[model samples]
Target: MRNMLPAAITAIMSLSVLAACGTAGNESGKPADSGNSSTAPAASSAAGAGGNASIKGKVTFLTNRTDMVDKEYKEYAKRFKEKYPNAEIEFEAVRDYDKTLKVRISSGDFPDIVLVPTIPNADLPKYFAPLDDLGLNDKIYFKDYKATGGKTYGIASGASTVGIVYNKKAFQAAGITAIPKTLDELYAAMDKLKAKGIVPLASNFKDKWPLQSWVYDLPPAIAGTANVANDRIKSDAPYTLDGAYAKSFGILKNLHQKGYLEPDINSTNWEQSKKDVASGKFAMYLLGNWVINQVIENGAKSEDIGFFPMPYDNSGKINSPLNPDWFYAVNKNSKNAETAKAFVKWMIEDSGFDKFAGFIPVLKDKQPELAQLTEFKSFNPTFIEGVPDNDQAIATQNKAQIDPPAMVQDFVLGDGKAVFDKFNKQWADAKKSLGY
Candidate 1:
């Protein structure tokens, strides 16, 4: 699912001056190194104004948080302007951010700053300005997520770990005294909730994207492999019956078969699901930690909502994947290149957007203060930071038309084995045709 953020706070009284950053290379697959540090470029004046005080100009920032554009985003712009009184930041919030941004990118008419979409790493320089001069490489996590040839193109805005966002009131009402630490315990808790006439979990099947967590995000933690996507590139039949894909999907399937999911799956609504969970009509949602704030905003008391890693198995050991949320990047063609770069830097460092959005800070030295995150840490789950998808792995999945979420929908609605067999065949054929 797409991400969302909340309103901004007061502007920082003191802001650091940043040097103008430059893009090192073009679309040709040449190294983007800026002839300074291997991971970042030396400060240069070619891109924009060199300091926050000197920064001036207007830049439009493209964002996915359409819900916050009118009020919250305006507050962000207001705070930003306090630091750079001469600079103006206009937000262009799109409901369908990835699709719209892709079209804008194809037409070479995107905004100055954007939440980097799902384009390949090799294509970064083709559209984005090098962010090396932001001097964030050494200080941030996932600095290399969008980097190639030692030059960073994007900086992660924040990080999240997928887990069960549950209502504590529902758990207490159902007499679930202990947090479920294993798959069996989770199912038992679901039974207790169901017996109390509550929807045990929200399938969110109709939304499609939320179902993706079961296949894309949960499997890595289930399999205890951080680089599972790249690891799949080595196998034509990555969807074996005994594989992590099967195990992860099976958990959701079991929920469906046992009637632990919401009734009338075809009519499930994402927005309503949040409200239902918040109101304790639904016990849980298997989603990222980011959803905690959304649930609270929908009326769940902050203390009533808690998060824990998904227990995909009964082993009691939990491995959660710590994944970055959308990355922030500067457009290569922005007329206000320096201003755009400065805005991106300011958003990352000074905006306080990460904490407000309930995400783990991308800055390595910073820690999230969310109570849910503190509770999650108490579980002592091994965190597996995500590995970037290999270009070839992505290519193979595209060629094979393997939509993990859709596969999950098929599993719950139709036959699980048949769905896997069909995809496995397509994957093998695609691999053979690609000579891999």
Candidate 2:
């Protein structure tokens, strides 16, 4: 992951203008605007072939952003239609995206363009079309995440980093003068906040999914390597007392055991937690920077919210995982593949959707201008890009029936070391059975 950052940085420094427009050629040796002209004539060929073909067809897009379907998405479709008068873009938004999409995929009723779900990387070719012809392989971050056999499948929509989204007003009210730089300092600040009757951290533990921040997201930072998941594949005893999993889970255990979390852990509400955290009832959330805008939208003043890397340990040096969010891909069976590919390109390059969604842009040449990201960078922390999990890694996890978030919930309720030991046994047995 570190190896990829320097090249991306060089690309960013060399760009005088954003790659959204102009004649700059990407790593594929094709111009950024090659097939993106609004007035170009429509072509019957797919857009992946050098991206010179103008797209015109009816294409269906499946998105998890149900909140934006009516307003923002409508505008996107309208603007896309204006660019290609003969084309039509339809969005099918689902509230339970992963579950619904999985069923749809099994029934062969999926849309043209869809967000890639939690599926094995090796199965990418079976469901999604190769996007190599789009000419974005080297131009975009996480280009290799869904690629196989030299053909790329999914293109990441955007990226985000894990951090502490805190309320500045709450911090001031608690008399905390500085941002916590170490685990001990963080605990001290949380104590101060707790004394002031603030829920020091909103552990949305009941939601199950948000708990992934500790197990899935923060482990990479704690291990100081993007290859944490891959590394686990090589060892049967991945969950040890001294390993990253134990340390990451240990922090959550400490938070819960010390009464620093919400009053009602099991009955916590995700939506209301946002409102509570925004209003300063909850002082902080160890979450991604993506939540900052949502918190502000929930009623917090924009200036009242601040972001910083989670000081998981007393290292005095911070490392955060710069991970990609959902990936956008074209359905392999789509009849309107060209239009789908064209829409994906437009969404990634011209739509400005990443900014609207408060995400770091996926294009290496385009740097995020978000205020929270600026504040996060102010600490001079190292940004570790995430590595994609291989097939064996995913298989081992599934075989062991290891759900990190569920394990965390159990850890909070029971013994942390015992939970880790149980999972370690299961993982070792699974690995031996699979002959890994």
Best by TM-score: 2
Provide the global lDDT of candidate 2 against the true structure.
0.77
lDDT of 2 at 276: 96
Those runs of model 1 whose alpha carbons end farther than 4 Å from true positions after fitting are 1-50, 95-100, 432-435
TM-score of each: 0.85, 0.85
- Worst lDDT run of 10 residues, candidate 1, spans 9-18
With candidate 2 superimposed using the best TM-score fit, by how many Å does residue 123's alpha carbon deviate from the native? 1.5
Instruction: Give the Å error, residue 39, model 2.
Output: 11
Q: Write the per-residue lDDT of candidate 2 for residues 1-436, one digit (tens) a residue.
A: 1112334643442343223222211112112332233433223255533334357779999997765677677878987787667679999987656657867886878999999876677888889998877767767778887778888898888777889999999999999999999999999999999999999999999877788788767888898887887788788788778888778888988998899999879999887998999899999999887777678767887778888989998989998877788889999999888888878877887776666656767876575645776677678677776767667777677678777788888877887788888988988888888788
